[model samples]
Target: MPKLLMIAGLVLLLVGMAWQFIGRLPGDFVFKKGNVTFYFPIVTSIIVSVVLSVIFYFIGRFR
Candidate 1:
């Protein structure tokens, strides 16, 4: 892939993630009421990864 396209793909990936979550994201917390706790990024990033992968995949195919 060209440098420009590679850069654009990265930019798009960042934008997609930031756009959906951003400040709206909730902070991490734990629940001990039932002696159970969990930790994770509430704002899922799988979509961002998928989109970026797809974009790059096509970019590679076109090259």
Candidate 2:
């Protein structure tokens, strides 16, 4: 449906904006060695999870 598409688009836009802010959070790990690299976003994942949980909790509470 058109409404669903619009909501999805909005969510994508918000996520893209938020990605720039969240991508470099502390406790996120990165390791590099000659010809090899590794990256993890542990802190970023936790922050996002907490944020989304709060948002949904409020939405559900109100509904």
Candidate 3:
């Protein structure tokens, strides 16, 4: 449990450092019209999903 928490903390730290770069990746959508605005991170979601999937795959394999 302690090891899991430590690993989670490290992942959060790295994500914070890279947050800005991740937000602006291509395929992400942002729109503005007067006072209304909308944002969706389609590409970002896919990238994150792929990365975590790969990580978990290896973790599962080792276990």
Candidate 4:
């Protein structure tokens, strides 16, 4: 549990540090209207999901 928490924290820290670069990944979308904006990170979400899935798979396999 503690190890998992530590790893999760580290992953979050890394992501936070890399957010500036990751925030504009290709396939992500941004829209602008006269006075409004909409943003969606579909590609980012898919990448994160795959990464977390792989990490969890390994963790579960090892344990």
TM-score of each: 0.43, 0.71, 0.78, 0.81
Model 3: per-residue lDDT, tens digit, 1-63? 887688678767876777766668888899999999898888887877787777668767886
Candidate 1 TM-score, C-alpha based: 0.43
* CA-RMSD of model 3: 1.6
lDDT of each: 0.65, 0.77, 0.78, 0.85
User: Over the full model, what C-alpha lDDT does candidate 3 score relative to the true structure?
Assistant: 0.78
Model 2 lDDT per residue over 1-63, tens place: 786577558766877799997668779899999988898989888877787777668756875
lDDT over C-alpha atoms for residue 59 of model 3: 65
Model 4 TM: 0.81
**Residue 28 lDDT in candidate 2:** 86
C-alpha RMSD by candidate, in order: 5.7, 2.3, 1.6, 1.4
Enumerate clash totals for all models, in the order shown. Answer: 0, 0, 0, 0
Candidate 4 lDDT, tens digit per residue, 1-63?
Answer: 999899889888877776767777889899999999999989988988888788889978998
lDDT digits (tens) for residues 1-63 of candidate 1 = 489777797777877767666543455344555666565544445545676788779867997
Best by lDDT: 4
Give residue 35's lDDT in candidate 2 (0 to 100): 83
In terms of lDDT, the poorest run of 10 residues in model 3 is 14-23
